[model samples]
Target: MKFTEELREENKDIFQAIFHHPFVRGLGEGELPEDAVAHYVKADYEYLNTFMQLYGTAISQSKKREDISFFQGQVAFVLGDEIHPHRNLCEYIGIPYEQLQGFPLPPTADHYRTHMKSVATDGLLGKTIAAMLPCPWTYQEIGRELKEEFAPEAEHPFFEWIDFYAADSIDETVDYLKKRLDEEAEAASPEDRQLMKEAFRKSCQLEYAFWEMSYTKEDWPIREEVLK
Candidate 1:
């Protein structure tokens, strides 16, 4: 089996859990609360700086020219393609995207970002690719799956959100990521391959936590109690 297929098989439970998550269900039903959407958007927007760094750092760490080139292209696409349009959509949805400046990091958000940074900065090629794969792959799969479940009209509240993930561009990016993962894995030792698998699984676990956190509007768990 291909690395992507094997990895997915290993974590099929988490993928199912994510697909069955209440947040995803609410999104499919077009009944997800606006506050939840806003919070998630804000959290995602706030992380872009660190996200850019992660990719850029990965590009620098890569030994292969193709890897560097791929990451550079992604950095541009992320800033120019995704964020600008997402900012516009946030306006339509009353998400205060502009007000996300210096937003406080929720626990889950911080943990997720820190993990990405660790892998990009600390891990080798195979491990770094494994850590980053789940986001693009999972989101694309979930978006396409959710759309199939709901079959919503173009005017549906979350229509554009669904379309964003299901877009041809996103499909191409997912393909690119999977191809990179395969290439990276092929060159790995048995021990490093196991590390790569663990990284992928951990990233998937964090993906689930992020959705749950967004649904519940998670915050610093004990900060208030500590202050008191």
Candidate 2:
């Protein structure tokens, strides 16, 4: 079966909900709050740091030496190249890098970290890849939307970040991930497929929560006034 078909069959609800979300739809059209986009970039960078650390630990624990080395390389590329470049996104949104680093991660972020760690440590590589698939795919899809909807206007802060990730590189990232998932799936057992599906669904739900957390504000009068 085709990869897209397999994804549809395995994650039907998640795919539908993501496509229907207002923020995601807006992101597709190059419309999102500047603050929100900045939050996403910062959040994603921090999450990668934690993820890579866990991936490193998992690789160290693996008995398969060659597989351990492969995972190590994957972690390095994702951290050193893919994730590190956007570390300064906090500055663009008027937040200091130190402040972003010190800020408490939301529950959604914690959930994502836990899920990835679990997959990396205990599940098949294919399952782990499945768990990681939604993030890049979602970003690429949103980027496509932004390119189509907001390229001409290009004035919004959110659109600025959107355009950068959704560019040609994002397509390449998605293609690479798709190929990885296919290869992993071909080698996976039925149990591994089930594990991958479960982890993928959980990760998607956490992703939705991550976005929601960014938009939510605590009811603090002083903070509200300051925001104004």
Candidate 3:
């Protein structure tokens, strides 16, 4: 089996949990509270900032023009195409997209960012990509699954969010990333491959946590000034 396939098979349980998570179900059923979704969109907007940074780190680590170009393309994709959902979400929330720009990530997202940053800064290209894969891959899967299951109408509040991830463009992006990871795996040591799997699993877990965070609107227990 391909390395990406293996990673998916290994993490099937977590993926299932995420699919069944209340926040995901609410999106499909068009029943999620406005506050919950607003919280999620704002946190995710901040998360994407770090997401693009990882792509930049990947570009810097790449030696081949094709690899660098691929990473660069992903950065553009995230910055351009991915933000449509945020805009739709902001409109739904009655907030300007710019207002959400500097929103702080809550606890789960902050930890997830810390994990990805560590891998992107210190790990080899394959492992770093592995850590990053769960975000796009899971969203693609979730989007496709929701589209197939719910057949959300264009009027659905979350339609743009669903459509964006389920788009052919996202499919192309995930396919490219999967192929890249498999190519990287071919040259990786067995130890490196194991590390990659671990990264993939942790990321999958965090993906689930991210949903939970948004569902709960996770926050630090005390005000930042309390400690000061």
How displaced is residue 107 in candidate 1, in Å? 0.5
Which one wins on TM-score? 3
lDDT of 3 by residue, 24-62 (tens): 998788777778878898889889989999999998888
Question: Candidate 1: where is the Cα deviation over 4 Å?
Answer: 84-93, 222-228
lDDT of 1 at 84: 52
Residue 214 lDDT (model 3): 89
TM-score of 2: 0.73
- Relative to the true structure, how large is the alpha-carbon lDDT of every model? 0.80, 0.64, 0.90
TM-score on alpha carbons, each prediction: 0.91, 0.73, 0.96
lDDT of 2 by residue, 1-228 (tens): 955458757766766676667666655554556666566665666787876786566566556776577567768667566643354345345665555554445557766888887787774566666777777777676566556765734455455556656778667656765776686767778877777777777877876777675655212234435877
On residues 1-228, what C-alpha lDDT tens digit does candidate 1 reach at each position? Answer: 898889989999999999999988887777777777677777777666776777887787788897799889888988887775356447556766677557777899899888887877665766777888888888899879977888878877677777788788889888888888888788888987888898899999999998898889988867776988
lDDT of 1: 0.80
Each prediction's RMSD over C-alphas, in Å, is 2.2, 5.2, 1.3
Task: Summing lDDT over every window of 10 consecutive residues in candidate 2, give the lowest-scoring window.
Answer: 215-224
- The best-first sequence of candidates by lDDT reads 3, 1, 2
